[model samples]
Target: MPIISKQHGNTLLITLVILILFSILGLSLLSISISGMSKNEIREDNIQSQDLSEKGIDRITHQINSELTKKIEENNGLTRTNFINLLNSTVNKYKCTSGGSIADSNGKTGSYNACIKEVNPTFEKNKPTVENELRKSIVFESKGKSGDSTKILLTEIEIGAESAPETLKYAVGTNINDKDGIQDGEGNLYLHGGVSVKGDFKVDGNIITRNFGYAYLNGEQWIQSLLPESIPSDGSTNSKLVLGKDSYRLTTNTGYNNHIDRNTFTGSTYSRTTDMKNLFSGEKVPKIVQRDPVISPIGITDQKANFFLISGEYYSTGVNKIPISNVNKSSSKIIPTYTERTRECVRGFLICFEYKNVDTEKESGSFEMNGTNRFNQFSTIGSLELTNSNSTFTKGLYVGGNLQIGNNNTTYNSNNYSDITLDGPIYVKGNVNIQGANLKSNVLLYVEGEVKIQYSTINGKPLTDGKQGSLIIFSKGQIKISNNSVNQDNPSQIKGFFYSEQDLEIYGVGSNIRIEGGISARRIVLNAIRGRASDKLFTGATKINSNDYFEGEVGQKTRESRLQIIYDQEIIETFSNLKQPEPIIYKVEPPLVKERKI
Candidate 1:
């Protein structure tokens, strides 16, 4: 009996061991299955999130582009409110909870909170969380949790071509480099609207901006503000515009106001005063002691007519001298002792005039003014020629489109109260003459073709008042401003002349450049015209200060008054520091994405 019991016990033990082994194998198989399922669900969720994020970006981009195009077409500037409204209108995000959901789609759900915050709305906010929200509606939120049986599905609907809403939607963000550092590549940046740069920046593409355009010297609040309110400490350490120092030049390697010997600088690089007048038409300066300050009053007659202007105030005397206020300054001083003196707006000057004879001027058509009653005026086309002839402008030439001039001696005239504003590019192909005492706005002179001045001059007569304004003359081709004829405005404000914010590009090797007026360009190609070199005897006596001169920083009160920075693709995609996850592409496209229910 004992032997039998022992054998039975052995058999039972073997059975128990076998059962334990099978249980272990079964558990392992179950674990593998669960892991595979979880991975599949995770992949699906990521695809949906990515799609939704892309859709959000698309909607935002469309709004930006549309707003910019409209602003340009209407000849108006863009505002922050405009951007915010567009964002809110384009995409409405609500919480996924039943109480928060709005326009919910599929089973995928989420929530959104208005991310618009306010700093100095006038200036570019520092990594503005609010602005970013408006620009990019989807802020990344991670998806992870404690152990549990949970599956999430996200759907995003991008406005793609042939897919419901036909919008050109492109995803832009940082891509991780194999070396780990993020690359600010163009591919990652998206340019939907016009972008401007207010600070000194190194870019990889052509930049275009309009109305109150300028580039700042640095990317800092204090630098942009130019006021102690931003940086209470010594403000002199801030970067200011230097003509020749700091190895600065109008164009790369091409010195500022330097003599071009072979389209390259030969003599010492200098910003000559004569070059200043040539680039910008105005009166000659008085030779004075270096660092001497001078202030001259401007004359004005009318009170009903309103006038505003932008001018430079030089605190120094003579040429190439630092400002007097900058003498013996620490590293934090804005500028050293002064060398030259220039100021604008001696008095408020208004531009207003009337022309009674219209039938004689417009023989072919009738044009309507925006505010005034119907009156016929002399046509500006082919009517006035400067063979030493007196020409008068009857009305303010307000431009809604571009103006192009052909090869011919055409005299452009404006009365003491008349002004000409090139809201768009003004292409001149022949010898063009301009005369006006009160220029309230700016003039764009682009000579893509030959331009010859028959002893013409831009002289600001009635020089008793020592005020002048600014001007810009740009030529992509041959140009010569050598006529003795005068072109000058009344001395009432510091005037800016021929200050192009764009890099000058010339194709022809025979292109010659000669300017008796102020000339500002991104670049200058003296050899664009091969034989035109000798013809280009750019002779003038005015000093040229290329690059926008820095004025410490404007206070918060003048944030919108100055040029604003452009948020181009490079700025968006290449912004320093902010890192985003790599775009997760999917094998199977996710379902259409919709805003979460509010």
Candidate 2:
């Protein structure tokens, strides 16, 4: 019995030893699982942080581009107010990086950090600043980097004044040297009479002359701003500043008789407004009126749609008739399409085309130059119909006739030294250096974008008439004029609005009132500058400062578009990812012992 008892006690001891071993294994497995879970959480946070950093950079760049575009449009192309608004709203914020956390488009939070530095930049301001003078820049580092996170944004801006030319000669006369096709080394050009230039004219530099000069620049043309208005928001058939009726204003009737398929018609959509008002508003649906049945210059279309009629010259108050019958005897009354083959060179020259006689051929409708000289000329014995036809002077374009410029920038030269009439408006997309001639138009002499000139013999007199200056600078976009006049001998006193998105700089002398979006200059030579068209001549600098001016802060907390936002630097919530850590399982094995006879 005692021996039996001893064996049982030994078995009991063995059972207790097995239980201890199992407990140890289970604890080890639990520890490993916990460690794995912690590591997984860290990894997930790292990925999210990286993603948030990238999005932050994108958001900032978007704001910058938006502000720039808005300013250019609202202020007629980047006025002082727009500049100030952009700087204060965007650049003033933490540019390079900040220690605070920035939320991304996904509403994810990540720490923002960046290196900030102001780099010197030579930038030109679209307008004069509150402190009148040439523009200065505020350049800063536009990139950021951290361990595995990186972000970048590059931008620059400036403000300053450019000197205006003092004298401009030969604003009127006849047959002198045709400076239209001259090179930059020939010095600033001036023309005043009937002119003709034959060559591949190229003005490698700035070409300046009086706007009243009867002249043209001759070259392979690269006219940019043909029609520079916003597409109409209202559903209208017209794409320009004006809309026409059922019949194309310039055609006998807006119709398609050509055998070509309808698919052949390709052109940019023109709108009377760009406000997006046609979407759901009570705006009337626009009936399409073919303005350009065929597009040539710039290849926007295949042919000229219809002839634009000058209200005062061609269309009488009683009945408006399509003049196609006038050209039926010569060729197709339809206007020919002249595609622009000019290289995308930034510079070009100008030339003038004049019909030798117009009295006898007044009833004619179409005129074309078939000559093949480097520069070609077409003349008529009477008042010929140069209408409903397209002409492209390989160089600059000059017109002096009852001419009409299409919504497109055609390369046709106008007959200089004649009473010029325009059915539509004259579009000066490139340089418009008029020497001397009366310019009459129906709508606006839209530049579409920029305007640079050398001199002005506007009205062949001073701008003191109409109780103001002689010239008017107007636009739906922006305007820029640089005086390159060299004839300082008798600098004509000037008047007009140095109107633009920015300030106007006038560097000449005389009596005049000036209206400008902004004014900037190092030395105004008060005798040469003026303010309001009614304000007395500015004998000195007429400096005015905006009451709502703000500069950008390179590293600070600022609101975007004046909206409130919070800047924080800590994580507000934490989470654990169990799936990220592979499960840690425990295993048990039976211990082996020999059952021996006791």
Each candidate: what lDDT? Answer: 0.25, 0.25
Return the TM-score for candidate 1, rounded to 2 decimals: 0.30
lDDT of 2 by residue, 1-598 (tens): 8999999999999998888888887788888888878766666655555554444444444455455555544543332333444544444454444432233333334444322234233322222333322222433233333334444533343322111110000110011112344211122111111111111111111111111111012311111101111122224242221111111101111121120111122233211232322211123222232231111011101101111111111211111221222111121112121113211221232111111212322333222222111212122111122222333222112122222222122211222212222222132323233322222222223232444433222221212233221233322232333222222222222322222321122322111211211121111101121111111223322212221111122111121111000111110000001000111111111111112110
Residue ranges of candidate 2 with Cα displaced over 4 Å: 1-7, 79-598
Which candidate ranks first by TM-score, i.e. highest? Answer: 1
Quote the positional error of residue 402 for candidate 1 in Å. Answer: 18
List TM-scores for all candidates, in order: 0.30, 0.25
The parts of candidate 1 lying over 4 Å away from their true place are: 1-8, 28-32, 39-43, 63-430, 433-450, 453-469, 474-478, 481-598
The all-Cα superposition gives candidate 1 an RMSD in Å to the true structure of 21.9
Clashes of 1: 98
Residue-level lDDT of model 1, residues 1-598, one tens digit each, is 8999999999999999999988999999899899999997777665555454344434433443454446423633223344445434433332232232222234333312122111122112443343332233232122212123222223323221111000001110111122333222211111111111121221121111111112112321111221111111122232111121111122122221222212222234322232222221113211111221111101011100111101111112232321111122121111111112222321222111222222221211111111111111112221112222222212222111112222133332223222222221133323333332222323333333333332222322222235322233433333333212112212122122232222322111111122222222323221110111112123321111332122222222232212112112222222111111111111111222344321
Cα shift from native, residue 305, model 2 (Å)? 28
